[model samples]
Target: MVLLLRQRGRLTADTLARELEVSTRTVLRDIEALSSAGVPVYAERGRHGGFALLPGFQTELTGLNHEEALAVLTAGSRRGERVFGLGSALASAVRKVVDALPEGHRATASDAAQRLLIEPETDLLSRRPVTEEVPDTTMIEVRRAVLAGHRLRIHYAATGQPPQWRTVDPIGLVTVRDRGYLLARRSGEDRTYRLSRMLAAEELPEPAQRPNQVDLDQVWRERCAQFLSSDHIAVLVRVHPARREDLLSTAVAVRAEEPDADGWLRLEVTYQDLWHAEWALWQLGTSAEALTPQSLRTSLHHRATAVATRYGHQPESRHLLPS
Candidate 1:
């Protein structure tokens, strides 16, 4: 109740009751309780008026415990405030988290947060991370539809396809590795689209067709299972320990792996297609060997032979390093 008042500036009795799923009497009781508890809550009498806090009024984290305050502070700091195009709101939340802490512990909490690091600029091999950019307008509209239970229309350009108009029942938004995606339903069929692929968006007045409540995390996992199981080309390869991550990173899934007597690791992994498998293994050169799929081996052999001929040098044994 207090949070709604603080964020919305003013909310009527009906608004508060509806938002909290409580009676007007309960809201009034809470308002009285807040005032009695030394909060600067006030009620204005008029059609355009409602309960509001005093200008510049601040409150301790009423609903959140002290530990939760620290967690918010840490998360906000780590995400750098600008996550999923909500930088300003996240910045405000972080400030609120800092202010909510006890006077003596605020600085200490901030210092503790600085010591933790996630998703560094580069890995052991100095490879950079991927960060996809979504236009601000597209994100704003998509978020509005998802939050307000409205249908969303988007101009999307999927991979290898021209842009098209799509109206969907927006279920939720997800961000992984800084890449944003919209999980929605189109024509009663599940669909997922990258936020960066949205050229434009509009929030429709009609309500979304999804459930009033949903287990968004569970839905995401189910969709991921379907996506990974579709037409994925499985491959078996032996990779040098030094480039294990290089091979694993490109593959969609790793089903099994073990170390051979020669100290190389044999991995059963899946890629998007045969071309993708061949291209990834070929990049490892002699440090990796594809053990299955004669097509992949033949493709790599031809490429290696062509490279050797261009340099007027005899290619080494076809099986990569000697067994």
Candidate 2:
């Protein structure tokens, strides 16, 4: 009621009741309550007048408790705003949220939110994930196209390739792991584009060709399955029990798994290619061993031999050796 009056300047009791989906009597009772609470609510007896708040009067938010306010403040601290190029807008919105809190809870909630961190800080112990830089203009256009059901012309720069102009039907936006993606279709084929890689974008006059309803979660899963099944090599490996999670995290897919007699885990995993498999297994050191595909084992052996030959050479000076 306060926000409505503040925004519209003044509203008749009938208008307020109609907008709020309540009875005029209810609106009158609420007005009395607001006046009793020291709010600057006033009514004009003339038909031309209605309820109005005094100039410069703004109401604090009364909906949130202290914990809910703290949660909102903490969520506002996340790095998600950087991904979509809304940092400035998010900052302004956060300020408004803080200002809306009750006087007694405002300072305490802000102080508590400052103590909680969303993403890890860059330090020796942990490396922060690099968030992609996207232009505000590009994101704004892409978002507008998606929301308005319009086709978009974009200059996309794929990895190891020059930027190419393509017209894609905007479906929806997806954000994964601090990276934003446009889940759209081109020429009736599903296309996914990274927002950071978009060099330029413009909305088209043609209506987008898309389903009436979209289930983005299911679409994302289907796309992931299709990607995993394309141009991937399968390898069987034996991994130490302690390093099971390390292998699972690195592999593209886990096809099969079982425990060996020696208490190690025997599993079949998929990788993008031979080099991908080699690199993943190499990182595990002796904790993981490539069992099948003689080619991978040979490649690992050759790489290890090269490393050994490079490091095994004796130094020319004995003084360089540690005591």
Winner by lDDT: 2
Q: In model 1, which range of ten residues has the least summed lDDT?
A: 74-83
Tens digits of per-residue lDDT for model 1, 154-250: 9999999999999999998777656778999999999999988899999999999999999988998898778878998878899999999989878
Model 2 misses residue 199 by how many Å?
0.7
Query: Top TM-score: which candidate number?
Result: 1
Score candidate 1 by TM-score against the native: 0.67
Residue 283 shift from truth in candidate 2, angstroms: 3.6
lDDT of 2 by residue, 132-199 (tens): 88887898898778878999999999999999999999888777667788999999999889999999
Q: In angstroms, how far off is 114's CA in candidate 1?
A: 2.3
